[model samples]
Target: MTFRARLVGAALAGTLAAGASALAGASAASAQAEPCVQRIAVVNNAAFVMSFSVQASNGLETANTDTYPINQSRTIDLTTTALPVSADVRPVVDAVAGATRTPSSFVSYCENGQTATYSVTGTTYDYSVTLIG
Candidate 1:
């Protein structure tokens, strides 16, 4: 091939290689860009009253909790947001709860500004969370 043509070909190959690298880097970034998550666990195993369970907000929008009942149901507000499970929040909570829970009935809601509400009926408890768009 002519020298000028070869140079152009090399330039095009280099451009393509650079584009691929950039794309790969973006993919890696996206893979690592998942929302930071936090969790808390509450274990209720006695017939006596339990202390108030408090939730900590760190900019995450989702929350999960599991409860084991001893003698009563435990009501937990996972979030401190004032908007407590509005219409927009309902579907998200319902979808997550439906997919996560078994034949059990659980209550979840969004409070606002990175807070949620969760309750468990059992004596054991497991909790999880993630930030949603």
Candidate 2:
């Protein structure tokens, strides 16, 4: 090939290689920076209402206290919240007339793209919550 044509070809090849390298670097960085998504579902099997609160390790908190009816489930999305590696889930049941029942068991370590289910079940005035999955 002519010298001028060869030089231009080499320059174009170098530019393409540099661009490809930069694109690969950017893709790697973005993959590492992507946040995890957690899907949490709370099931109430008791006779009364139940409430729940979820807090991420990064101090992001989400709660649902709208009186979850019996035999129903509520799902919360924690993808937008800044969760570090785990999260804290607190559940309370309104089993009694003027009292609240707080479950001793809670959920931790919510994984990415996984669904965690918390089920609350018991007789009236004696409710319990446990992580089923």
Candidate 3:
């Protein structure tokens, strides 16, 4: 089922730790620190199928092998196979295989239990990743 994105999540204490911890804004000393263990909604509104993959500062990568159809949204569970860091959802496959799109969301944007929505819109030649909550 497609998970709905909400407006909750992410808190950093003091200075962020190094590496992936910094991206996640998590530190052992920070009492409000929380991992980004939540559902992510990938909404594809483009003209062709879209493939996505996630990369974290902690050297963790999850490649979504399935192609998402246009006008469809896929709910991905990051609670188990991922960390708390802000991640990059790269559009790896589409009509334009060599085109580039940079759209990212901070870990602090959504709470642990909340969902984050990353929508891809437009055609392959002029695609953009919508940074929505």
Candidate 4:
């Protein structure tokens, strides 16, 4: 090949290589930014039925169980690109009952595909959270 033609060919190859490298880098970043899927299972073992919402708002939308029954579990689906995400399990408490107890929430954090189980045991005033990776 002519010298000038060889130089032009080399330049074109370098440009293509650079473009491919940049595309690969962008793909890796997009994979890292993919939303992490998490599951939250809330079991109501208490005697009375209740309502609640499970959320953290750390880049994920809030999920709720509007009317949870006794001895049953409701799973909430959440997604976020952020790591070390937190779950705020807030149960609805009757304000007219006695002193209007604030909702006893169980706050916990989980990773990608991890499951957090919150059990409402004892009474409507208490709860517990267990994280499973």
Candidate 5:
């Protein structure tokens, strides 16, 4: 081969190798950018059966809402491409005999692991809610 041809071939090979390396690096970075998963548990410590809804917002237009029964604990799994900074829990009070209570509401922020637990307390006349990591 001519010397000029050899030089051109070498330049093309080097360019191709550099491009492949860059693509491989980008793929690795994308693999490392896994979506985050958040776990939330709700427990009811009240006498009457409680119903509650959980909602998670993560900048995206989509929001997750689900209602679950209390007394028995419920675990909610929230998966999002971006981390969820906040969540809201709203309770619905059921009519109980001789009971006058208001539903409790809670707002919680994400922790390092994005795990939280909320509990419903108080009697039929009054309801209290708390959230903790």
Candidate 6:
């Protein structure tokens, strides 16, 4: 699992927060800060398999001495590990001025086997969750 990519969960939370703010305006702050509301959708671009040494061959063996690869996939369900990455509704509210709203959602794209986080600030919350393929 791309734990680094999981960081995107925070960014994802931020986007969701921004969207809530846009719809609720002043009330978005009161809303519970959460990342992956229920079943967050991630476009299954590809699946990447990471090999971990569940058990070492011997005491001298390292946990991740061996390496493996799995295809990367999009359209991931975050409900199972539904945990808030981060929370920051204040900054989002502060940024929102008149018609110009910061970012209400994340427009993520994968490049070079990594999901590129776009330009979005304040609203993005950072969280972590377990992913199973």
Candidate with better TM-score, 4 vs 5 = 4
Better of 2 and 5 by lDDT: 2
TM-score of each: 0.32, 0.52, 0.56, 0.43, 0.40, 0.18
Please report, as a residue range, the 10-residue window in candidate 5 with the lowest summed lDDT.
Answer: 56-65
Which residue segments of model 1 deviate by more than 4 Å? 36-133
Better candidate number, 3 or 6, judged by lDDT: 3
For candidate 3, list the clashing residue pairs, or say none.
8-111, 9-110, 9-111, 36-84
Ranking by lDDT: 2, 3, 5, 4, 1, 6
lDDT of each: 0.36, 0.63, 0.56, 0.51, 0.51, 0.28
Model 4: how far is 32 from its true place, Å? 17
Better of 3 and 4 by TM-score: 3
lDDT-wise, the better of 1 and 5 is 5
Show model 6 residue runs off by greater than 4 Å: 1-26, 30-36, 44-73, 85-133
Better of 1 and 2 by TM-score: 2
> For model 4, how does the per-residue alpha-carbon lDDT over 1-133 read when each residue is reduced to its tens digit?
9999999999999999999999999885554322233666667666666655554434343533566567777766555323245444332332112221223343444456755555555544444333322
Better of 2 and 5 by TM-score: 2
Error of 2 at 110 (Å): 4.9
**4-123 in candidate 6: lDDT tens per residue?**
888998889999999987889656444433221322222111122222211111212112212222232222222222223222211111111212122233321112132222121222
Q: What lDDT score goes with residue 6 in model 4? A: 98
- The order of the candidates by TM-score, greatest first, is 3, 2, 4, 5, 1, 6
Indicate which candidate wins on lDDT: 2
- Per residue, candidate 2 scores C-alpha lDDT tens digits across 1-120 of 999999999999999999999999988555431222366677988777666666543456665546667888887666644544545544444544535655455455446676667787
In angstroms, give how far residue 127 of model 1 lies from its true place. 6.6
Candidate 3 residues 18-114, lDDT tens each? 4566665545434331224366666888887777755554456665647767888876566555545445333233444535565644333133577
